[model samples]
Target: MNALGLVVEYNPFHNGHFYHLAESKKETNADVVIAVMSGNFLQRGEPALISKWERTKMALHCGIDLVIELPYAFATQKANTFANGAVSILEALKCQSLCFGSELGEISSFLGANEFLHKSKQQYDELIKKQIKTGVSYPTALTNAFQELTNGKEILDLSLPNNILGFHYVKSIREQQAQMKPFTIQRTSAGYHEQNFVSPTIASATSIRKSIFSNEGDITNYVPSVTFQILNEYKMEKGLLHNWEQYFHLLKYSIMTMTEEDLLTIYEVEEGLENRIKKNILHAQSFQDFMERIKTKRYTWTRLQRLCTHILTKTTKQQMSFINDSQTAPYIRLLGMSSKGQEYLRSIKKQIELPIISKLATFRHPLLELDIKATNTYNMIFEEPLRSKLLKAEYATPPIRL
Candidate 1:
């Protein structure tokens, strides 16, 4: 009755993901798999290619025993917060271990890197700040600084998808002092960013999404048969987030009307990025364009998008500080679970420290309430048909018939 944990977005599950799940089961001999996944929006600050339910179905179809929603506050945030939220859920699930895909897939290398970063003192912090002052991007500066100590081998850069996320997971585990063990499965076939899908059962989600969007060919070759079957039940178009354009006026107005203090209240604002953001708000045409105009060496694209999402969600600096100072998340929201998962919940229900939320109607905490409001606003950005459908989206779909 061992249980393993996974933290994922599955934005759309593909072969590489399927491989990781199978490997996790084999390596751990676990009877149940629990995942804390992103909801409508992803960490990159972009909309998920599909709805969260679709992604959950995909995971359940591929052997996951339970799927929980990672709140938007963490999902559309930077690596640290995103990891903080996801890892918190996994720890609360009482998993014995966590398994994720990694490019190097060498656990020791990541551990060594994580340790070095942890031991960094004033000297290391100053070096990174100094490098960043020289106009190198934050990622580049951090990499260069770590290279000084490890001869370029100890630092994991976030610009690359998997490695960046892997480091965050490691860091979060250390921060929490959680008991779950960590493991990695080397990624194969298409790389995280690779656009082509040539592998028999290990294509990147990027390639699968491209194929699904273009209607060029059947994607069954890259995803599980169950995934293709569920996807076939509907016609999904690219940028299920197309209605995002409707927010243009709202964004423009909010930026223009907000005071300098208001801009500073947004999370991720630092060292006067607020002024630049405000300046670009009036001149830039679209969200992407505004982001480009304000982009700077100190701020990464994902960081900037997080700032935008923070502003869009009206998250203030005060709130960010509050959440950070708070050591634990308020609740773990359940997305879907199998009968075995239900049994696990019963086993851990009292032992688990955090509250588990399955419905939104009676949720009263301000932070939890904020998550609900954010999801409602997120639903408004979906196409007309999906708008209500997403709000009414139910959990506990019949267990994935694998």
Candidate 2:
């Protein structure tokens, strides 16, 4: 029952991830590792390089005992929401501890940062609003707000990407008044967007993905051999390795065709962004080009990209708002579980509040439906024999039991 939970994308589960999983368990002296992993889509507004099940299998093959999905609604949103959803899942699963990689690699500063933000919420809000009105990106505006409140502390800069997420996780845990204890493992290799490998054994997912897209044939060094073999098999079968750019035409077609009213209905579409996106779609050549043309100080690229994904996938504002307002994850859908994981689930089944979904046929919810849509959307990207075989029905693919 005292599991150490991880919030992960594992875009491709690499050696660095394996290290974190191992270290987190050791640090917490946890009995099991539970991961609330993002599904076919990720937090960065990019499609995952491989299917979620494959990534789940990767986690199980390595060390993680149980993999539960972070539903598409929360998995592909801003960091705060992403953290909220992941933490909620872990909490609902009755995890006793939450572990994540952090750039600052220390708990005190993160705890301090969270406390400061809470105490200075009003001041921070005013500063953020002022910065946003002056045409700064929300993230930069947030950093500015934190700086103003902290009286020019470099905590924001030092935390970087992962640490920022960790801060949000702690904040969310407090917001939920959840019992999960928190722990941090210092990130040991390349940073989130670092384009170079830190060592033969550790590389950023960004770099490994870059190598995959460029056909560099040098990625196996960073990822485990199981990963290497699985990726190769996926490539031959499903044309696996890809990024957001692969969906250029789909995004463009969706944007170019949707009415202003239609765009407004999509989640995160607001304040005449529909007009801006419509105006730019004709001349904008690729997904990257289109993103640049529409991106403004008021709207960050990732925010805009998530909106684009929402439009393409038909995730509506009403649906997302319903889930957000409920302040609860709709259900607990296991992705894959080892025998030990199964034992844990059996032990906790009656205590957990939400429905534990084993078959899609047995329960239906809009959020889970959205997840299936995201998966099927990615499934459409493949060609030939793999495309047909890779096609999955939400009901048909039962959680893998190892």
Identify the leading candidate in terms of TM-score. Answer: 2
Over the stretch 284-334, how does candidate 2's per-residue lDDT look in tens digits?
Answer: 888889888998878887888788888778789888885668655878989
* Cα distance off (Å), candidate 2, residue 276: 1.9
Residue lDDT tens for model 1, 282-333 = 8888776887898876677877776776777777776666467764567887
**Candidate 2 deviant stretches above 4 angstroms:** 154-159, 384-389
Candidate 2 versus the native: TM-score?
0.96
Can you tell me which runs of candidate 1 are displaced by over 4 Å?
153-159, 198-201, 211-218, 232-250, 256-260, 281-286, 382-402
